[model samples]
Target: MNWRLIGACTLAFASVQFSPALGQTDIQSQRVQFARGASSATVKGTIKGYAIRDYVVGARAGQTMTVKLTTPNTANYFNVTPAGSDTAIFVGSTSGNSFRGTLPVSGDYTIRVYLMRSAARRNETANYALAIGVTGRPAAVAPKPSVDAVVPGTQFHAVTSIPCKAAPGQPTRQCKAGVIRSPGGEATVRITLPGGSERNIYFNNGNASSSDARTPKFSVTRDGDTSIVTVGAGERYEIPDMLVTGG
Candidate 1:
């Protein structure tokens, strides 16, 4: 082998071995310590670009832990990972910036803070204050009853099928709907659409509303025995008076 060719091969091998290490990001971890006789702690830090910081706190099973993050960057979020598991049970981005729940198992739970990929790639920086608290002793809780155990026709106070269309020009389908009334005269109507998806409409004090009230195009109308409700632009449902009054 020629000397120049041998030197070129060695340089290429060196680049292949060390290139991944240069691109990898290392996580900085800090242990959380509560004050004497206190169960809570607040820590402040700054992270830029793709840097990540993990705040580890020791907690026992069944102890309720609360974590709240305050930052100016909307892309920054925290995730609570339980002991011995890589999965996070609580995600701050979807669940809002605060979390309060009883931990499942015991060990050092990691609260990972980082920016989203979009913001990280821009090399943005976030100055944040993380508040963490652990309270209450380990206690067992009884499992509550499952809502799926309620039979659609028998358990519901009133059940019927109604004509509905998901959008304009869509073929109408007979959707199964059920109504459950409360002592306060408020009623909840659960409607099952063509593909088994469910929509819940509420009736209170003579007004009808759906869970998503943010839609600006919602309207209700009546035609003889049927009450036509439209959510958004074209999703329509016709509810008969008999379903509300119970014939």
Candidate 2:
């Protein structure tokens, strides 16, 4: 790492301390925490070449948060950096399966993960898992309808009502990924935009993915004091707009 990058990392860790979401208890409490003294935030991941790095401290506009890999590996030599504002903070290089990057954009960013081949383990493939946190408390939960049964307007500030009998046979029902309920499940919802950029929203916390496979991708391009989401699956009672109040 260069002097400028090293200085940034030092300043970031030295100046800010992250906060864990309170009352947001989940199942993966054991896999989280640094050493008890670091903080009580708990985010868990069970993927290769990656894991939830750390909960950033004092995450705000114009701030840079660095996430580190838990272990180092040689098979995977590097990482991916997002484009545009997303690229401002990113996975720069390979440091023993660990990395140093900043959070440039806010409202749920991602670390594009990949793997490299190893000389000894010639067929080595990576299946990484990761998590996120901030220096400040997680955003408060907004009371949203568990299931909306109505059509909504383009600017969806109001919750659309999903009638119990909206579907033809009334045989299907929707499912929700409660923030504090499950902390180990994974959801891979891909949403493509007009700009040719796709957003891969992963919703895990145990309740994220269901056996029925009814989950949605949540993303915001701009304009919002609130976090809005929409489910992608065609389940009758599927709800994608979940509240992120807990870790």
Candidate 3:
């Protein structure tokens, strides 16, 4: 993570309306081009004081998009907005220098890079490199696993038990794993079963004293040292380093 200090520029602001159907605006913005499949573009540009540079690209819902910014000075940040909407879908600032996620809607997405509002008053100018990439098919939901299976020769220490539902026509069971907590308010756990693949489980709030019925359940198995985890379709989990081992 890069801590880029940004201040707003002093340029006069303009009110612009975007067409919802085309997701386009009359405002001057740079159009970015990419080849089919996985592609990336790096644009070198400067943001004058109180001014913003907008870059637009087309994307489909479910595709993964990543954007990164490198600035000559710390006074720049970037935002990503979905087509036809003024609200930013993603924002990268001093706390983070990049953004990555699956787009929720298909259309033209805009990436705007500029100085912070405070810096705008001074008309600060900074050079920056903005890199953007979009790839992969539209995200699809994953089917539920048939049964809770454990891989052979793999062992996981019990962390806590949580309620989980089985696939349709399958039996339900209480899930358990070897869990590790993160400072960022999440937990990573490893689970194993006999003759099944290894899996890692991620959830919010590892500090739960007891399992909540609302917590989404995942199935896991083990394959030697690797854990194979499966979740419901359209679900996502952040993968973190395993810090603990279960017996």
Q: Tens digits of per-residue lDDT for model 3 on 49-126?
A: 666788998876446789999987676888787653454646665336688865544468898877765566566688
Instruction: Provide the lowest-lDDT 10-residue window in model 1.
Output: 13-22
Best of the candidates, lDDT = 1
Deviation in Å, model 1, residue 229 alpha carbon: 43
Worst 10 residues of 3 by lDDT: 5-14
Q: Model 3 off-target regions past 4 Å?
A: 1-27, 36-38, 140-247
In model 1, the clashing pairs are none
Candidate 2 C-alpha lDDT tens digits along 26-138: 21213233444443233334323222222223232222334544424334332323222112123333234343332222233334333432221243333333433334322
Taken over the whole model, the C-alpha lDDT of each candidate is 0.65, 0.28, 0.49
Q: What is the TM-score of each predicted model, taking all chains together?
A: 0.48, 0.26, 0.47
Give the range where candidate 2 is weakest over 10 consecutive residues by summed lDDT.
Answer: 148-157
* Cand. 2 TM to true fold: 0.26
Ranking by TM-score: 1, 3, 2
Give the total clashing residue pairs for model 1.
0
